[model samples]
Target: MKFTRAICIALVIVLVSSLDLTSAAVEEEIKVACVQTELIPCFVAAFIGSQPSAECCGKLKEQQSCLCGYIQNPTFGQFIKNSQNVFTASWHLEKMIIHVNLTQDNPMPLEAGRTVDLTYSVNWIPTDITFARRFDVYLDYPFFEHQIHWFSIFNSFMMVIFLTGLVSMILMRTLRNDYAKYAREDDDLESLERDVNEESGWKLVHGDVFRPPRGLVLLSAVVGTGAQLALLVLLVILMAIIGTLYVGRGAIVTTFIVCYALTSFISGYVSGGMYSRSGGKHWIKCMILTASLFPFLCFGIGFILNTIAIFYGSLAAIPFGTMVVVFVIWGFISFPLALLGTVVGRNWSGAPNNPCRVKTIPRPIPEKKWYLTPSVVSLMGGLLPFGSIFIEMYFVFTSFWNYKVYYVYGFMLLVFLILVVVTVCVTIVGTYFLLNAENYHWQWTSFFSAASTAVYVYLYSIYYYYVKTKMFGFFQTSFYFGYTLMFCLGLGILCGAVGFLGSNLFVRRIYRNIKCD
Candidate 1:
């Protein structure tokens, strides 16, 4: 449960993937005119922290063609480094060339031909440096598979398997009353006393089945988030297929925001419809409750994190401009969409069907010892969603790490489909079991079920640490956690929302199906 809370917090953080893009021709075009001066390459020690002189910067910029040659020449081979080993050209000037500062006082009056070492570094001045490197599409790793701290594919699968079994048991055995071996039908009963004796166990909540869930805030929050997420997934897939996504730098973002706006309507519809179905009279309250609650909670945390960063001088804001843009999109675009969704949902064709009609008493609970406990059963129900993504998530994880040239849009769309199906199935199973266990009062159960996949993700991350990543220093470690955090948050929201929606529909369906007396 605490983990779920952590995941919800993770949801609002900003993550922008930055792919390295540099080119060779672009590198070759740059030219600089340096006051050429000869020096002993042997004074390598002095050049270690030396500032780049104007002549060095000028020459490096002008004679960019010779820079690589300078580093490669045996006389100055010592300057070559692992970082400098890259063949790619940086478009940025700093990366193109290195400037060696020459001074009068500590003049390098060295032998005609000395040897030296060279390397790439950023702790240098921003003078005659030119950029090199085009694009990075290396298939390297440790980051993707190794350091992904949460939302492990394995744990997710296990949870799914457990839940699937639980669902099977509930759907097959629980309803059947252990094969109904020791039982008889109501009319087929030997006596009315016998029927009453056995029927005293589990039955549909006549009065409370339709009793509105107590936590309006939680319900609204779940509905709103689910609506937003369902929209997000649908949009991501549609955009991916329509060639709108992956077409440019911000296409995905644009698509996300647009889809999110469009989804406000769904959120309104679902929440309003659910509230209406549950017999709640205040539809306006429900609409406002959800539309405001989740966004506020998410953005509130985002603000807190950003404030901390700002206090520590560590970038605590999402850029004033971005926030303004987000606000405009949410207010102007998304709100109206939500209002329409509410209207549609209120007039929903199916919600009016009355799921929890006060009907005949449901079959009683079995007297036999059940193998599955409610917790185990509910947990098991959540695992299916994870199973759906196990293979696909691995590829996505790898693609990001190895810097692989991933352009398979169709494949991603397929994975997204799989994720949705899995999430829905899991949610349905979980809600069903919870409903059976007579825990309908807890509205957040299904939400936690779906989001629990993050546990497996975290486990895998730990495993990857020992088996994959070799980065041990603070800076590298920071980067590792940073990227993995983004991944966890993204996956968390996805799974959670799926579970929530699935459970909502499942409960409503089951409540409606049983014939009321």
Candidate 2:
């Protein structure tokens, strides 16, 4: 750590010494001016495009000494790695030159409202890559505007607002009805279930609905698998924020794999517990599913993408070295988590079904067509989560594989939070709606709702690839679809799992809140 600090200090000294005289003079007559922004990357990208803008150039020159410092600092590093690798390769720039001495009479060029300081333009040649092309940018106002930023933010936010409103309204209504029925059953505390059974004619789920799924083990496995995926994302994000992994680079992949492998414990635990609650009997299948599915899916997709990347000269084949690491990780790490979850689950007794006294049962199924059918509700269920992501997902797809930088982690985090809310609300509403419709078996409703988003995502990707992307061809198409599907499905499932967890907690809590008789 000390050595790294020393190197940084030395670099700063070099930078300051190199820029002092020229920068001071240029500051007054700015060549490349920088716009103010909270994020460092925004400053850089705008400044780059600002090159043709004399004001921007002046600012860049003035700041040359400090550029290295900015690079060293964590906040600004994201911008450097993210700007301009894709469609706008030949966009105009507004770069600054630090030390160009400007005479008082020879004033630096200025924008309409902004002043230009001393700056110099340098010949920035593009790298010799077969696919990507680049040319020098003219420093102009046109370059300073970052189009994608607004496009994504607007698109993403709108979706969130709509979805959140709709989902929330539906769930709240369901809760109200459930509460009413629950209140009605307040008299018969001891035989609440029996009273409910007597009072109602149409309960969504009958006695068989509560039957312990035959394969307790297999149910546990699915739960575990889903849990592993859940942990993988949380750990990756936390690690990135903690600086253990660089989000800008491909270290995200490694972080995900490691986190996923490690999270087998969470998967096993959650899956087993949920299954037990559902009265599932099979536990061994749960273990196998928990351990095997994730590794196999990841390995298969990674290999496919790697092969496609190889054919296109975009990446080398997955090294045998990586394969060894993968095997080691899966064999040693994940298996234990599954085993541990199973052991814990078996040792731990299941919760009694009657956490809350059943206040009321069902009313006669009035032979009336319902406004919301399970299938329709299930389909609509995905809209909330999908809305939360479509705008951001659109940008992400364009950014990845297309070689663009997405530096808006702050905004992404905001969307993520919003997405979580939307998913839960959707699940709760769907589950409630189904139950109210006399179709009470909604265990899978949580998963299905979130999974619905994946459908929209896949469709959107298809449209973007065919319509928006100009440079990519058939192989890119195939590779794109393959990986995109992986992302959407995984994301869908993750969202669904989150919804399920949240709904389960909600349902249990509500069920526990009231007295039956």
Candidate 3:
């Protein structure tokens, strides 16, 4: 009886092993069938047409287990990882449907007896990855969270500290001596002459420094627009943080448009106050220009891009109804708010409060070294500010160009604050240098200095296009550069306004305590 039982147990073990091998072979065959017959043809046909057919769905349901096995297999993993949800649903016998809509207005016709194929691939193994964290497969964690990124932020913070210290030292030491000399009660002609001779730089141009800059209307408009843009960006960043705007289609853009319309008053107020203080008589023109300058520029670029999109029959083309809605929002809400703000600003803060009286005849600006010239100073002023936000720009470009979602608004906020500080410090220094060269044309110089930061950013975008992205063809290329140009324009204006405002305060403070004839 014991020998008979042992032989029976051995026979049972052999039968079980053979069944396991047979199951493995069946699974392999099923996987091959699923990939070749069910997945490839269905996915390709669905991509080319509107949606998958009933037969395609039935085949996918029948091969659900095989699909999961393929997902687990290293060789076929990439081809089917995205279909995990389908496999899971099918495994549980749940009803799930997927639809693919082709965006082309005029799709090419399929030739008789000809077949089309699509090769879809992904670089991820979802064995241990959760559905929520699936996007991590595409994110470049090493690039974004690298030590160099943190170091860049730290370096920018240090630069702010150093610049503030330098400016403070100038105020305490250098300016103190000048103040004591100018405020002295010495009635002696010789002493006064000596002090006058020593007071060559910056002090000589105090009278002309507060004079209205050339193109005053345009300057006021741009400054106001910049102020609005600054507010718009900050609001958008905050909302994105709170709302996870990246998860929703067109959420960020919708927020931006609404916020821009709401913030139109800022530009008007700033422009109006500056224009009024500068003794501008063309109030109507300034108000109109302030309200329309940026919007028109964007509209022009968008119009061109929209035309191209329509020509190509691409989904990127904006519908006429959407365009009309945007125009309505701008015309009714933005324009009126800007007008109201202008009126309020003119009434409230339009009074001139210059520390030094303007001379009837403009002071003759002496020739300075090339490096000290406004153009050169303007060009160089952007370098440090650009450096401050260089790393942040890489992340931003990647999020937009690549299929990555941007969720790091906290980092963005910090970088934005740093960019503001760095821009102000750099612009103030450039303005000081220009003023010390006996030039009173510091208004536009300060604006241009900060605005030049955008020039460098635009140049960086060019480099990224050629090196970091595989974007090709006329439509994609035109849209890429066009959108970048719009972004850079807004950035330039915002930085320019911040720089001017900071330097204006500095100029006022420095000139306030001095004796001016």
Candidate 4:
């Protein structure tokens, strides 16, 4: 256990150090002009094939004096000289004439109230890579408008805080009263007599609650995969939150893939440990499933998407060599690491102790009230989490569909924290009620309860595609819904793990602390 923890800590330190260095290098190397900043709106309008706003035209006029100087700079000249590579601007005005000259002595003239369609492009040339190509910037009309969602985010956060405080107050008060009542019974004989007459609440199902869940192997595998992904996502976002990981479009995907691959060991260890603790002997099978299931699913979908992009002759298609590299990374590097982790997990950690011993004969559970039923509780459990992020979801959806630059990692990190808190709290409260109602089958229920939030996320995507976005065409539709499915799959796993682990800890702690026979 100590070795594993040390390895994880070392990996984190390395990633953070490298990221900080990379950020410093970028800041030192990249140079931008003051007038060029004004051209930002023009670039967005150009990229999205929209009419430049008056503000954009105004900036263009203001920067006319520096046009010649900008033309001399390689960074700026590349865009001006290679219109085909830089952007595809469409002229859609009734009467307009434009002049282009790199050696003109006089400054360029810009007239106000004239509309010009322009596309802007930005490319990231990594210090390590030599090849360079123009990358299109696809922000939508009225650039930088998405940042205004900060108000909605603020409102949502306040509401979440209020709800969290309310829940905390209620839980604390109720648990305190329960603890006091249990403490009042000083003698075991008195407690036994009281228990015989009217024993109630969560303690009533103590023995059954800790019984290894049915299909324990599969549950362990799922939770293990979820746990690994949760950690991976947290790390990735932390890097972004520190302003290190969001440099380019490629950087985001590259970082996530690398992190996901490296974290396979976590998946294997968690799954194997969980399976072993659950009294399962098929540790190898569990490890394999944990390693393969999510990766295969993601890769299969990506392969299909790449094939479609290639068929359409789209530049978005990933190259065959790239595909091979990705395959090797997963198959050779990640899978082997997972195997090693499984071995370590099996040997390093002995079986975990359950709060209550499982009986050879399972206790029969009483019928549950409708409100306490798994289906109802699961549905409600998901609502709070989904609600917490719904506001941020709008901005994210806009960024994906409208080709907006998503630079709000700080806001995203805040929303992520809120989602975690909400998922944990709701699941714990729901699980408590279920146990109190004598229902001990919380393995899948705890998972599905939290995962159900993804159902709402998908539904919102459908609504966005049909109502909010003007995206049309077979390719657009396919990409939107397909990627949405992948996103939901990941979200479900991350949130579900948070919920289950939180509730599991809560249940064990409460049962262990209580004065129960």
Candidate 5:
């Protein structure tokens, strides 16, 4: 989650999309700039309370109207980070003050060559006070500081909403109609006689649907870790929304690391309960695997990326102190909490129940067409989830790689919800189809079906590297792909868990309601 935290910080800091606005003909027409380049020197002098040079003064006077235009421009308004900075400054020192005496008490226009009397006062501040200032200053205020890609966000939302509604409508209508037909047929003697022969598909295989996946221990570990991560992310997002976090540059990273470390209890509980339900007695092994898998993977990837950052002398690199802190937090607080949760979960969890009893002999799965096969279904299953998120993903990629500003967390949170909804819907629908096709190996299928979204994410990342980003060099490329891989890995786990849980519940409910003999 450290890399995810880094990505999240990188996610909401800015929102500038890549656009090619300068054309050859437009460039040819502008002989001089709208704002004079020479005025920069004058602006610097004014910043330190000094008078402008003669040339600078001439430029300032010449561009006074243009300066006013720039100030009025909304795009230029962001240049001043905050107007309240004067009050917030650490020291209250007056560099200089001037007093003027006018002839009239009321405001009046100045006559040519009019004489005015002026008084001056100045206060000095100590070096210590000046050195204590921590806030940033900008030479010129920026435009569109809180800018969001509203159009893109809205478009993505509409598309996802349409797809989700269509899917839900189709599934509900079809399932309701089928349930009605099956119920009516149950009263007919002829239909009842034919059911045994007709039920050779899903009905015949109900016994195996609840069978534990082959790698139950590892799968349980993945699901638990993923569930913990999902909850951690949701909490962090809520914190940001409520302003508990979102303080500054490092806020997201700091909050994410702390929240994720503390949430290890969730992972332990989920893993222990799942392992117990699957009839596994090795609680310690389950706990170790659940706790270690993602952390080790993240640390390994982060270490490599940090080494690259150190090589390039980039501040983005995680410091030694920060790494030590993270390690200590994980080892001391997280591990202990996980152990406690594991014990509680093992004690609290009861024996598992299946809607239908399993037979002593396993049923053979009939042959499936290419389209109905697991590989094809898994590949196709990711499309909707990917579509729901691809637009938001582009913005996220732009923020990380292109050094753009992106402060649209609200939009990001919305997109995230839509992605989860889509992942669950598609995976459940896919699971239902696979079951009807007489394929009961749904455990891995459900996970891979939803986790397949990561494949598209990785593929799009490749496209972005070639088309969207002009980034070069071995270090930059490696860092991009390496962090991307981690991001995909985390995404897979999170999304796969969503699909697995949803499909698991759906299967249980449907089968439990059926009056099996």
Candidate 6:
């Protein structure tokens, strides 16, 4: 039966080739040619058993007279005659239907040289649905809107509320006491000296707290890039909510590229202000690094993925023209905006604003408990933030990997805001602890603490790959993890920068009220 169907399909191909159905219109006077051209649609309808379009049916009715004549010709008649038991066609009330009847009750044995009939049918049923809504059938609303999903969102929201309250309590109760004690105006020198000696924790490191962090240049660049990415992600998500960007092919990617270029100034302004305030001497290098850091990282990943795709002959490979266009966009638009932003930032808000004057000699960082160490603090800082967004990550992963359409942008927006708030709160708390441990190097520690959220997310992705998804093979696994790595990298940097900036402000505000020499 399969062999018989193959022969019939081959015959249809041969017939289509002989007719030379070009895009040129078939004149009414050339009846044979017109019928042959119209038959192209019928051939497709019969071959694939799909519903015939209005155009296909209209052409069939107009050229109905010439169809029989062409089919009966000696050259084409033999194949049609051989396949007559397997193929049948009829038209009724402007509808074209092809039916192939096979006797299924009496199963035929498959043997070489035995002719078995193949049966199939094509029925064109009218539908009122518009062309734009053809994809509605594929959307699984129940799965997306399940009770578990809503519960997860609510759970995350509660976590945010809890974290917010905790942060507020720390600021109001703990900080207020510290402020009152630090701001005491004692007239007696001996009492003042006693109080100074009693001060232990954050106050002891005031002079060194605001000193420039190590690796000032690289830190500034990543922070700047992370700032740009944060803004870019927020803008893209809002646009997706407003524009239904998921409906169009490559729309999200195009929007990301364009928006990233337009938002380059954010990175430049941020990196520039940070570098200048830190007294960094390499201005040009800072500006360049801020501009190229994220883009180059993505480009390197994309280049590897594209090479793998090309090797596999997959359409996923990015064309060379697209690469050139992306490079041109960065070079012409993104790079210059970053440069302009850097200049503006350097001249505007780049002044040093440290509340405490740095001492001449660097303070030696004393050893603390294992839990209070920077590495431990950084690693532990991400837990609450990750918990806040863990469920959202599952939805996102399903949409990207499991072929589900993600339309819950409102949920996403809420989750994103929650992640940001939780990250900031958690990192600020971690920074406070580190400072209390007399660790003056809170800048990078704060950044890493917040950035550690991405580490958890990446680890979750690995677990999801092995358990939740059925993804296998080197090509698919590599692409999945590679893309996840890129996402986590950006996420880590964005969260890290947010954490550091929050800690920076907290440190500045608290110290501003104290008597720093």
Segments in model 2 whose C-alpha atoms lie over 4 Å from true places: 1-219, 244-249, 304-315, 349-371, 471-474, 513-517
Count of backbone collisions in candidate 3: 0
Per-residue lDDT of model 1, residues 1-517, tens digit only: 3323432222211000011112333222221111122322211112332333445544343333232223322454222311222122222343433322211121122222343332322233444323222222232334433433234444444555665677667656665652253243455646655644654222445334554557754575466656577667766776677764443566676777777776777778777776666666677767776676555655665666566545533322367788788888888977777777776877773444555454344434333335334455446644555556655655665555544544455655655665666676666765654555544443466666777676566556666655665666443454455556655655665577677766666556544444444
TM per candidate: 0.59, 0.62, 0.77, 0.69, 0.69, 0.78
- Model 3 per-residue lDDT tens digits across residues 1-517: 3323433333332223223232445444434433434365443333332234566555544344232212222343221322112111101112211111111121223233333332222122124444444345455777677798788788878888888888777778877887877678855999788867666478888889999999999999999999899999999999888866875689898999999999999999999999999999999999999999999999999999999988866658999999999999999999999999899888888478899999999999988789999999999999999988998999899999986777878889989998998888888888888887899999999999999999999999999999999888898899999999999999999999999999999999999989898
- Cα distance off (Å), candidate 3, residue 117: 12
Candidate with maximal TM-score: 6
- Per residue, candidate 6 scores C-alpha lDDT tens digits across 422-501 of 88889888988888888999999999999999999999999999999987777788899999999999999999988888
Off by over 4 Å in 6: 1-118, 123-129, 187-200
Winner on TM-score (3 vs 4): 3
Query: How far does residue 312 in candidate 2 sit from its true spot (Å)?
Result: 7.4
Error of 6 at 159 (Å): 1.3
Best by lDDT, which number? 3
Model 4 stretches with alpha carbons more than 4 Å out? 1-148, 159-171, 180-200, 243-246
Cα lDDT tens digits, model 2, 1-517, are: 3323443333333333234243333332222232232233323423322322444334444343233122222343221212111111211232212111111122223123332232322233343332211111111223222585566557766766775677667546644565566567355666666646544322324432334434445444555566567667656666555563433356777777777777777777777676666656566676677677656776788788787767654434677788898889878987887778766765574764744433244334333245556567667888757766776776677667566554445556666777777777768767665655565445565566766888888888888888877645656667778788788768766776777677667656555544433
Better of 2 and 3 by lDDT: 3
Model 5, residue 473: distance off in Å is 1.0
TM-score of 2: 0.62
lDDT of 3 at 364: 94
lDDT of 5 by residue, 283-323 (tens): 89888888889988999999999998888655568879989
The global Cα lDDT (0 to 1) of model 5 is: 0.68
Cα miss at 41, model 2 (Å)? 40
